[model samples]
Target: MKYVQLGNSGLIVSKLAFGAMTFGYGNIPSVYKVGQDQSQELVDRALAAGINFFDTADAYADGQSEEMLGRLLGARRKETVIATKAGNRMGPGLVQSGLSRKHLFDACDASLARLNTDYIDLYIVHKTDPFTPLEETLGALNDLVRQGKARYIGYSNWPAWMAAQAVQIQHERRWATFINGQMYYSLVGRDIEHDTVPFMNNCGVGLTVWSPLAGGFLSGKYTRDNLSDPNNRLSGFDFLPLDKEWGFTVLDAVREIAQNHSATPAQVSLAWLLSQSHVCSVLVGSSKPSQLDDNLSAVDLQLTSEETAKLNELTRPVPLYPNWFTTMTLDGRVVEALK
Candidate 1:
């Protein structure tokens, strides 16, 4: 139910964004099996619980995610902030994908029709298109805002350096720059901390965490002996690469903290991310209503400083290159002036 301004923008968004990624049976049948009836129930529950921000993508479930979300929201479409992405291949043809001016322009119009909305609250570049010129992508996105097709634009799953360059280009052109980002950040995956986190912090961009559960790895259902569950998405998708041994070590601590708070390990894992200042919202794309309810309750689970410290220290990403070099060379800000 808590809200904050999305990145640098004035538009307020819920701290927990309901992702419709699992709302339909498409390419990823195992994960996206929640049909219309169940999707309706889940969407209703999320809205009733005060979630006003919904996220989907043109690529998710082969665009069925967007369609189902549109149908589910129905008359309440205007009441929520709808975000969708392009640049991911929605079809087999070369012209059907990429961030080229041709593909992006056609993609936006297609997304609008699928979502059944006039303008997207936040339109995003789902993935990088290396073959396309950066200017072509940036200019096309700027045009989306200018034409009222999209109100804001952002990037997901992009490298920190590439994101910075895009921002520079957008700023130089006096166009709309990315105010928010959707990145894979979870208790099990802290890789973004080495670079992306600092980049977003300095750039004043808000972050919405995707795969906050590490593709269900942190659900506490998997143990050292039982690594794969046929019923879980990890068995099929297995996308987010993780250090399993390290994950178990962190999960042990998460379980203890969850026990102390009378909560589930999943909620504790989400609460750890929610406690982070840089995280504007955490996407919950659970197929099961019970699981979604569990995730929604995470906003209320406040971990103690001691608990938060334990989890942070356990899952902290090791400093890389200049990050380590810079920290090793800090000086002058000792106890002199303040004392």
Candidate 2:
């Protein structure tokens, strides 16, 4: 249960961030049917397992998820890091969401009220709003920090260039910058490797990976044999669209390592992410305590270099365009190997 610094900030968060996305609305439209009692049990289990960071979104179950987590962790509020997002519709009104100052502040306050907390550990801009100027959005966020409403800021589901631009704007204006980035990154979704990963590495910003399992694709619970099960979470939601043929290749490799470690395939999948140096935290969300336990145990599963090498070989994507050109053009430009 190791803790890593959040970007360049002083706060040290756990290696796994419990995601509250699954806390509410089981399979309903926008609002899944998750009860409070069940939600509390899951929250208690996560904290008991040494998870210190939790993530939720304003739009999740129409904010019911935040409300539940707030009630669950409100007493020991200072002990954990609570992260939630803005830029999603809070209601039918046009002003209820987005990155504009109106929506940002309103959304933050609404989230705070629901979570039953005064300050948010990490407040993230859920997405980029081309309609709103970056200056306006960040200026409002900086105001939140100044007001002690939020300790740190972050971004999610944003492009590499947009993230870099926000950091630069903050620097020039001397405003608070986003020290962390929360986005979809995993063995199956390596698109960030080319852009987002490099930007975070160079800027000293941290990466909090969401959907690291590609919405349960890497869990090994989904196969041609069980795809039609009505109880399966991924049955209707085939989210984040995976390349099945390619995904199975990674799955086959994961099974081999899981067998070697005497662990489940899901544990091997998460271990693969934890083994990466750039990942500060991987978010895990579940509807059952058993599921959470499986994810928690992944922290202890260590894949040897040989095992990792094999998995990488099976899942690595073919380099595209400019990246290929650069590697080819720069090959052998410098000579020398040493210790």
Candidate 3:
């Protein structure tokens, strides 16, 4: 139940955010589980465990995630912080998508109605909206804050440069700025280490990591040989683009550490993220109570410094372009070897 500041904002949020992406079903949603009753039970358990942040998206389950979250929150909605995303296509029409003022306004109202709440604690842009100008998107988001539709703003699945541009636009126009980052970060997928993580820390934005387990690969479910059956989401969706060879290498290191610590691979994977200084919160979604409990246990799991260094060595990314040049060129305060 540890808490941290949400980006630069003064508001404190739980380290583990309840992800409601699995709250719906049917043809539109690629991955959906836990119906209303089940979702309600999970919500209760999460709240009991001191998780006050809940995240969902309009496109999930065709707006079912929002509906379910709102219904479950009911009278206790004010006790928790609710965050949902926009900018994804909600319908087949041309105007039903992007960051246009029309879509932004309509989407917020729709989310508000669905959630049965007047205002959202944090509203995020789900992805880059190339069709709309950044200024237009920022203006619309600013209007939402003024109208009390949303209290704060955030962005997800955006590149470092795009995020920087958005922040610049906000600064120049005095528009609502993004206070947090909701991005895919995991022990197995260390791609964000190249740019996103550094940029986020520089901008003083809190990071709420999604897919901290690399879609169950770090959950200790699939191994080199055991991955034969392609039934699970990772096998079926093939999302987050995990590097199997590199992933297995990291998992071998994780196995040794987990054995020494008497923890699960999943727990070690999550603890690895929690150990990072820039990570403000980790978004975790589960279908069962047991799964949620196991995930929650990560907040208490502590990896020794030696274990962390070994994990980092196995998963560290190859520096790309300017990063290589910059590190090679920068002269900073260096410690001399003690003779």
Candidate 4:
């Protein structure tokens, strides 16, 4: 039910964004089997729980996700902040993908059609397109805003350096800059802390975290003994790359904290992310109503400082080269004084 402004933008969004990746049936039949009826029920539950932010992508379920979300939202489309992504191959043709001007325009129009909406609340580039010039991509996105096709633009799965450069270009051109960055961030996958977090902090950009459960490893269903559950997405998809040993160690801490609070491990894991100040929202997708309910309840689960510290220590990322060198050479007294 909590809301926050997305980065420095005026747009206010729910802290927990309902991801519509499971809205339609497609290639991953096992993972995304929720049909229209079930999708509606899940959406209803999410809305009832005060979740106004909904996220989907044209690439998810081969565009079925956007179609189903559109159909379910129906009259309530204007009540929610809907976000979708492009730059992913929606078809087999080479021209059907990337952040090229042609692809971005075509994809945005198609998404609008599928979602049955006039303008997207947020349009993100799903992934980087090295072959296309950054200017081409940024210019096309800016044009979308100018034409009223999209209200805002963002990028996902992009390197920190690339995002910084794009922001600078947009600033120089006096165009609409990105308000947020969606990336994989979890207790087990703290890789974003190295550069992405610092870059976003410097640029005043918010973060939307995907796969906060570390592919279900932090969902409390997986253990050292039961690591292969056929029904679990991690067992089949394994999308987010993580250190299993480190993940399990963090899971143990989460399990302990969950027991103390009488909350589900999933809730504890999500609460850890929700407690972060820079994170604007955490995306949670589910095929079942109960799963959605569980995720929504995480907004209410406040972890104690002691518990948060334990989890943070257990899952903290190892400082990389420059960070380590700076910390080692810098004078602690001077840094303390500056702080």
Cα-based TM-score, every candidate: 0.97, 0.96, 0.95, 0.97
Candidate-wise lDDT, in order: 0.90, 0.88, 0.89, 0.91
What are the per-residue Cα lDDT tens digits for candidate 3 across 231-333?
Answer: 6667665657867987898888888888888888999999999999989999999977888988999899999998899888878888999999988876554
Each candidate's clash count:
0, 4, 1, 0
- Which runs in model 3 stand beyond 4 Å of their true positions? 28-30, 332-339
User: lDDT, candidate 1, residue 197?
Assistant: 88
Instruction: Please say which candidate is ahead in lDDT: 3 or 4.
Output: 4
Tens digits of per-residue lDDT for model 2, 145-258? 999999999999999899999899999999989999998988888888887888999998899999888888888888877866877766666668688877887888888889
Model 3 compared with the native: what TM-score?
Answer: 0.95
Model 1 residue runs over 4 Å out of place are: 332-339
Give the CA lDDT, 0 to 100, for residue 64 in model 4.
Answer: 91
Best by lDDT: 4
- In the range 1-339, model 4's lDDT, one tens digit per residue, is 999999989999999999998777777765678888889999999999989999999998888999999988999998999999998897889999999999999999999999999999999999999999999999999999999999999999999999999999999999989999999998888999999999999998889999888777788888777677676677767767777877787788888899999899999999999998879999998888988898888999999999989888887889999989987999889999999
Candidate 4, superposed: residue stretches over 4 Å from native: none
Cα TM-score of candidate 4: 0.97
RMSD of 2: 1.7
**lDDT (Cα, tens digit) per residue for candidate 1, span 159-178:** 99999998988889899899
